[model samples]
Target: MSYNLHQLHAFTTIVSSGSLGRAAALLNVTQPALSRTIKRLEEDVGASLFERHVKGMQLTDIGAALLPHAQLLLREAENAREEIDAMRGLAKGTIKVGAVGSLAAHFLPLAIDRVLGKWGNLHVEIIEGVWDRLAEGLINYEIDLALSTATNDSDGIVAVPDCRWEDNSFVVAAFGHPLRKKPKLTLADTLTARWAIPPKGTAPYEHMRETFLSRNLDMPDIAVQTRSVTVLKSLVAECSFLSWMPEPMYDSESKAGIMGTLPIPGISAARTLTAFRRRDGILPRPAARLLDELRSLTERGMAMQTTR
Candidate 1:
């Protein structure tokens, strides 16, 4: 009379679909077979699970109480199976990773490589967006983990072990811009320039704006507002717009004659890059290990930097 997982699934399906016939359609089982499973489950509990009416069946109090517990049990089972499969080095599961634009530009592709190298059997998916979308995804269970700068606000997502990463960077512009020729750049110099800005409501963009605010500077009339760092960098190269970015976003265009940087006093523009997941619990091993490799690769990439 003891219930098994299948019985629990059947009962839950009946409650969810509101009728045995509908539940059979949803579960892809014969109506009689599904009805028998529900009957068996109810007998095991020694309680009626549903009361039939004109439209469909309604869960009795015992059934209502069991619903959440049954769902949790099934979820745990799925997680356990994933863990076991991961331990056996068998890949073949889905993980949604949230990546902010700036980091995704440089580090995320490398991180993807490391994930693939380590977990060849697993399929990895990346959800690229700014911090807020990523945070929303994590909260809505749309993403498994997020790589972002602003983990300070969320209580529902857990930051990873050893989550510290840097965001401070030098102000950048095309080569031979007047400030680049100066011995050192001052906060006042920032006012003289047209600046490309990040879209509103993002960590990097907000951090850049905050830097200006902290220095008692007016928001540099955003010469251009864009979500694409690539676009911002291109504008810096081809046109006359200065933008702020973490050093990791720096590249040959930034180093060669195309772009130049000026040292702003007390300006590390320090930002934090962190990984967050469901505060409710741990990731299944496949995702956990993949995440570990990704962070290690990012760490190695960052360690190569000589932080000023």
Candidate 2:
């Protein structure tokens, strides 16, 4: 059972404009055409969506319930059109992008390369911060899209679905340590160990906390907490501390047998990644297209991972 999108559009316009005449004026169609649209929509929905009221047309119970979905559907359809236009080189605009350090270093650059290759003149500004701070920037309207493993959805922000990807992260230590050669590791095994962690409010900190608590363990004793993972990486190389670093970072060191990740049983690599846009405004077309490309790239990456 499918209802026509145009009818829903006409019904929404009539409801919002408060009268058939006003809706017709707003839609740039005649009153008769708009009426036919609503009548067709009501028959398809199997209910009367509005009733004559003193002000104009009042939404009946079914109409009231359906209004939000209708508006959303129409907006999404328009966004799709805009995305098409952008791809065809008919739309132009700037997109401000935000990301934490690692995502800026790893994924976003590749996505931007694809975006610019397609659009030719897509103006993009990159804002760098830790995830929590980047999310705050979004809430404050300082940035348009954020790429991160964690998305703290809040007022005035919407998290885009199907935007997350899996990351098989590692717990790395300098090779000189006694436990470095161990083939297996556990949450309990790492509990008493000193570690360099991102501060408590950021993604890495929360991920570490959640992973431990999920295993029924209390917070591991952290030796240092800082926002910079670059600094933390250098710290891990010379100290006895353990830190969660993505597997790709240690691949070079692993070949030399100077750094390695402990294989923790019952644990696999995973992470939540999301793209955020403002809740209250129109999304610029070019940015939206870039998001689509990013989504496709992420899907392909996940498929390759599954195959391997």
Candidate 3:
């Protein structure tokens, strides 16, 4: 059945704002009008979308399922308008990107800077998280692009094959840590060391586990686990904890002599980084622009490595 954009907007706004009155205020319409819009939408759907309550409105199961589809349609409609505006010389659009901590630290900023330099009017929104969150953002249409460690293509998200690169992961510790004094080191030496890392099941955590398991060593007992990059870095730098991280994620700290990679011969490994997008829908132009910049930067980086 066909649905009106106004009705969908009102429905989603109510869900976000948590009440008819607040949504009406935000939409610059009367509460009665907002209510009517939702009623019509519910009629169109042939289902009670929300249950009214003293505190606030709550979504019915159908409404909960419809939210993502509605949001996706709204986002696509906005993208269409932005595309027309750009063609008309408005040069205005928004790029929604989600990335893991490592890419957000350096590579993403470089590409974003280039995009902003060229299209100063464009708006950009970024969410930094692990792969799971990035993938969720893609499926929900919250982000048009995702930069993350390479993973198998899942239900609604697919990698952009050409937009991939490799980064090295290393076992690192603060420069002042006792391990730095050792002329030689092995994975076995780190078994007794306190460790901090991303939570179990994350790509970084899995990589660390595999590194130890490959050599028949048990994973070290983790002293702390966190998703916050700042917390993890502080623990490693100030608390004498060892951690595994991609080079870019800790590059600045390394350059500043705050931390250094352990010289364990086989602990370092390469991980493939990839760009991902929703399997369906045409990517918005602004995201495409940023993706182009990412590709160019990756090519330049690879070229420099080749020359070296």
- Using all chains and alpha carbons, the TM-scores for the candidates as numbered come to 0.68, 0.61, 0.86
* Candidate 3 per-residue lDDT over residues 241-284, each given as its tens digit: 99998888888888899997887886777788889999877899
How well does candidate 3 match the true structure in TM-score terms? 0.86
Name the best candidate (by lDDT). Answer: 3
Runs with alpha carbons beyond 4 Å of true place in candidate 2: 1-93, 150-152, 182-185, 246-260, 302-308
Better of 1 and 3 by lDDT: 3
lDDT of 2 by residue, 182-291 (tens): 56656688877888878887777777777777879898778898877667767777777788765544555667876767667665457766787878667757677778
Whole-model lDDT for model 2 versus the true structure? 0.74
Comparison by lDDT, 1 against 2, better one: 2
- Backbone collision tally, model 2: 1
Better of 1 and 3 by TM-score: 3
lDDT of 1: 0.73
How does model 3 fare in lDDT?
0.88
